[model samples]
Target: MRATMMDELHKPYVDTARSKGLPTYKVILKYPVRHAVTPLASTIGWQLPNLVSGSAIVAIVLSLPTTGPYLLQALQGQYMYLAGTFLMMLAVLTIIGTLLSDIILALLDPRIRLS
Candidate 1:
């Protein structure tokens, strides 16, 4: 976010907005901040899978009653149907996350079109 904002702040459009006498807060929020959010939105989409995978380890270590441990148990026991269901759920969740991010990106930036 910091890097993206820094890059955005230097762009000519931001400079143009500043030159137009917009207040600092308005200029920053209306320009660089809007552009800077794109990367963060995309990062959120990418993190969904990681979050689910990480939860499995965390659940095992903490001895929690959750889907993560159940998934691991199913896979270890060669329960193909149960294991496949879990895997399918993860895949669907990842696809949803990606689709949502694309929609959000399209809304945030004029250059992106859902087409």
Candidate 2:
């Protein structure tokens, strides 16, 4: 995120905003920060699945009474229906996360259109 912001700071539009005599804070917020956040919003969608998977692994390793261990057991036991349901849930979650990110990206960056 920091790297993105730093890169955005050097973009031509930011320079143009500065040259136009916009206030420093307004220039930074309206141009560079807005542009930098688009990447961060997109990344949040991808991170959702990673967070779930990481937590599942942690839950299993810690022997927590959670669905993570149950999911593993279901897979190992050949419980096809249960395993399929769990996978479907994960897919749904991924889709929802992506949808949310798309909405946020659209809101933050005028270049993105939902249609």
Candidate 3:
């Protein structure tokens, strides 16, 4: 991702920053790093749900009291309503994670909100 970000940066932007007497660190931060943050946040945001929920297989195998085992049991018992509710809850959490990522992105670069 860092390599891709570096490749995407416009040379003119770097040149302009350098011409303004910005040090290398400042120039990189103002140009490439800042611009890269949005996509990074987006990737992290989508993965946040999984991180928080943990691996269902691991949870079930370990007999943890988290949602995974309950969801599995609901499905196995043919309890459609309960299974659906659990699925919905998971979906909501994913949406919340994505929204959090967007908020972080906006905070990191206020220009995003303006556009």
Q: Highest TM-score, which number?
A: 1
- TM-score computed on alpha carbons, candidate 3: 0.75
- Candidate 2 has its poorest 10 consecutive residues by lDDT at 46-55
Residue range 2-115, candidate 3, lDDT tens digits: 875777466787888888998988888777786777788878877866765677899999988887888889999999999999888778888988899888888877787856
Show model 3 residue runs off by greater than 4 Å: 8-10, 57-66
Tens digit of per-residue lDDT, candidate 1, span 1-115: 9999998899999889989999999999988987999988877877787676668888999998878999999999999999999899889889988988888888888888745
- C-alpha RMSD between model 1 and the true structure: 1.8
Per-residue lDDT, model 1, residue 10, is 90
What candidate 2 gets wrong by more than 4 Å, as runs, is: none
Better of 2 and 3 by TM-score: 2
Among all candidates shown, the one with the greatest lDDT: 1
lDDT for 18 (candidate 3)? 86
Model 1: how far is 73 from its true place, Å? 0.4
Lowest summed lDDT window (length 10), candidate 3? 1-10
TM-score of each: 0.86, 0.84, 0.75
| Candidate 3, residue 48: how far the Cα is off, in Å | 2.4
Q: For candidate 1, what is the TM-score?
A: 0.86
